[model samples]
Target: MGTVDRRSFLAWLSTGAVAAATLGRGGSLAVAEAERGATAGEVLVLRGATVFDGTGTGATADTTVVCASGRIVAVGRGLPGGLPAGARVVDCSGAFVIPGLWDAHTHSTEITPTVPALHLVHGVTGVREMRGSPATHEVRRRIERGTLAGPRMVVASNTLDGPDSRVPGATLIETDDDAREAANAARQEGADLLKVYSFLPRDQHTAIARHADRVGLPFAGHSPSLLPVHEVIRRGQRSVEHNYGMHLSTSVDAEDYFARLAALPDEPTDPNWWGRLAPLWEREAFRTYDRGRAGALAGLFAEHGAWHVPTLAVESAYARHPTRFLDDDQAQERARRWLPASLREQWRARVQAWPEWSPERAETELAYLDARLRLVADLAEDGAPVAAGTDCGSPYVFPGVAVHDELALLVRAGLSPARALRAATRDAARCAGIADAGTVVAGAHADLVVLDADPLADIGNSRAIRAVVTRGAYLGPTERQRLFDEIERAADGSEAPQPAGPAPASCCGPPPE
Candidate 1:
């Protein structure tokens, strides 16, 4: 919970000067010995917080949690007897303590300079980045080396899509050999996971999955148009993202629906292909949702140990209140703070240039989103593992802040507050295959959030962050505020920038004919 002036903070980041010489794992002092600091191997105690350990054991009150060497050393009723002589202690009499939250989906690169600081202030200690680039890799490297302050990151390879892919810099794969080559190349670049994208052919998807499995990398992404949900799960797709092909699979006319989708050209010449097809997808999927089939799919997910990252916050926001997401002045200003000026204007131009939705069209999309949400509820009720994800870096989806919104949305989808919290914490960790994070327990990483309010009482309280401890680097209340203040200053310092490229179209809206 240390505070530094803005100039000094920037200096510290560039040069490795720290006020405390705290030890990291293996008793290596992470900083030079300094005055008035906790000694090497000394405990740091958070005393008297109501603890939600993220394992669903419910809350334990008046507990003391101790950290040393970046790991939780003990959790008990009071400071353990024979505490170290120089233990650092923080009073947490009425605070709520939980494992640090995870945003199961995020995107980061040089364009988002404030992403790390923004995420830290909001207590997002871990992120599952949906795509990777050299810039993104540099960001992770700095964070892992303690040269930057940010979340623990797990990055996927550059997206693998068919030739008509819309994503910038996507690897275009066609045949099975192409997919295998791409997967091997990504693995060689040290990707933590594979991100298969829309329009991937069935044979290529199979080849990528087989190669990822052979190389011990878990594959999780869109269910390709030709791959049904059940088939994806059966083929060992680790996690399904964003409810892409799931809607078709839950409909009564699943076979016909999937067949229709699969029959589309592998690489459509029209740039508006996905947008043009979205209405049909929404109409049929929402109208024909078979509750029985949804229930069965949920069971199948559980049986196969598959997981879901629904990204409810982004999709529902776009569907129900597109204006709030796209045109809100306050949100735009915040985005400016968190993203570089050019990126901010790029996002703004996209919103301004997109075709407008009629009231009826908006309502229809909302109804469809609600149906999708109900499917999430059904899946959770049937024991299908769910993780909270906000597609941060998509238009208007603010990093760090949106995950809390996601948790609330999950609660609205019929999960208990406790269960919703788990989706962002424990279940999210398990889904990402990260064993050491997402819990506050002995030997776990000391990534934790201390809140002024009880999250179990209300999911919104997850945002009431009083402090965040990530990788044992503590950001006290003052430090957290400083982070936000600096982000605002950075944004305010910049001149407005010109848009970088063509205005982006809406995710579901049709292109101009």
Candidate 2:
């Protein structure tokens, strides 16, 4: 894995260069104050934009949204009364307003304020941190206390796995006692959820589930390899990340596949045994997929209220379309220019390490990707809740920007543009168990994105950000440009940041012994 110098990154952010760049010209003091949540009594109005409220309803035209004290006070066509005195109003004519997006799965806090700041720059106002540590906890605290300019964060405990854990630093749960202790520890540590991994023993997994239930902490992540998907769902996994076991579950030969998986050695000789094996399993599952079985599975998810976060962006980059960076010159250049040097080098090494695929193998992988996309469509059709997540911080998955890519992928997978938008906004918020967010309405957080074009017409238009309103601060074109400039400077190493520590393990990579 790559390493980042977080201390250096923080130093760069604190430097006068950044401050001067952001505040020197075209910067609003009110915008700066609002970002720090110091605009307690200030009112900001977004007028004349069409509002996509994220409630599955059609967009409302000519809407006016009033925000104060970091919350939306009113949203309507025209306030029955005139605007409040001393209110700062933005004329959003011809723009489309939508709820700020959420990256439902991220390890961004490992990089601290840099990743979080990028999320804000991309109009991602909230994130669910997939793995939490003392550092991440402190980052969240700072964001909430108005001392940091970042997104609202929902953090999960460090991953829990069985003996011979795939990830380094994961809490190993070999016995029921260990499971119970881990669950309680997560709750005591104030984790938003307890994250489980694929290698846990069945009994320990069950114990953790029950204990989390009793302790009122939601448990989520990969379905344990020792158990069937139905059993995992039955045990009340709040959300399944990456559609880990679904392809097998929906296969016509699922029982046989499960038997084969169960017979594999628990302690494999190869560290990435599962990673090497999963594609073969997925390809076979795709060929044998049963529509009836898939429909039933989707129905079960809906009935149980289990949410699915298909982080297709990372999956595509690393698994299904490993050659994307090699094939797309523009993409390669963008990644090289944007990623920190260490991270870029690490990702390049990983990509080069992939075995060269023959034409037939490449086609097979593409077909498997198609199958996954169809699976998402089937789930959406069957009323199974689907949320957009990019699995950012993984190899080749850029933070913040990938959320938009995931939305586009969802649309390509047969979801309407509006439904895709909801997956990133309302559905993502619900999946993360967050309240009073992900929608534009009275009493919700004043987090919004103003787009130059209608997102409902073209989900790609989401990238056409005219302005961003977060923490009751309106970051118009000028403020937004300043932010982009600062990020560029940091990315180019013009502002020297010192290396801090080892990079967190990639969510998709093989665990270190």
Candidate of highest lDDT: 2
TM-score of each: 0.87, 0.86
Residue 385's lDDT in candidate 2: 90
Give all candidates' CA lDDT scores. Answer: 0.74, 0.75
Stretches > 4 Å off in candidate 1 = 1-42, 109-112, 265-267, 270-279, 321-327, 492-513
Single out the weakest 10-residue window by summed lDDT for candidate 2: 23-32
What lDDT tens digits, residue by residue, belong to model 1 across residues 174-245?
777887787788888888999887666667778888888877898888777566789988888889888777
All-Cα superposition RMSD per candidate: 7.7, 10.0
| Candidate number with greatest TM-score | 1
lDDT by residue (1-513, candidate 2, tens digit) is 112133432332233322333321122111222233233366787988888989878998887776777777566664333333566888888999999999899874555445667788899999998888877888888888977667889999988887856577788998878888888888888899999987777888888898888889999998876577888888899888886778888888888887876666665576445533543676678888888887888888888888889998876765554545766777676566555666666667766665666678777767877888999999899888998988887666888889998999999999999999999998898889987889987667899999999999999999999988887788889988887766665664532222222233334532222
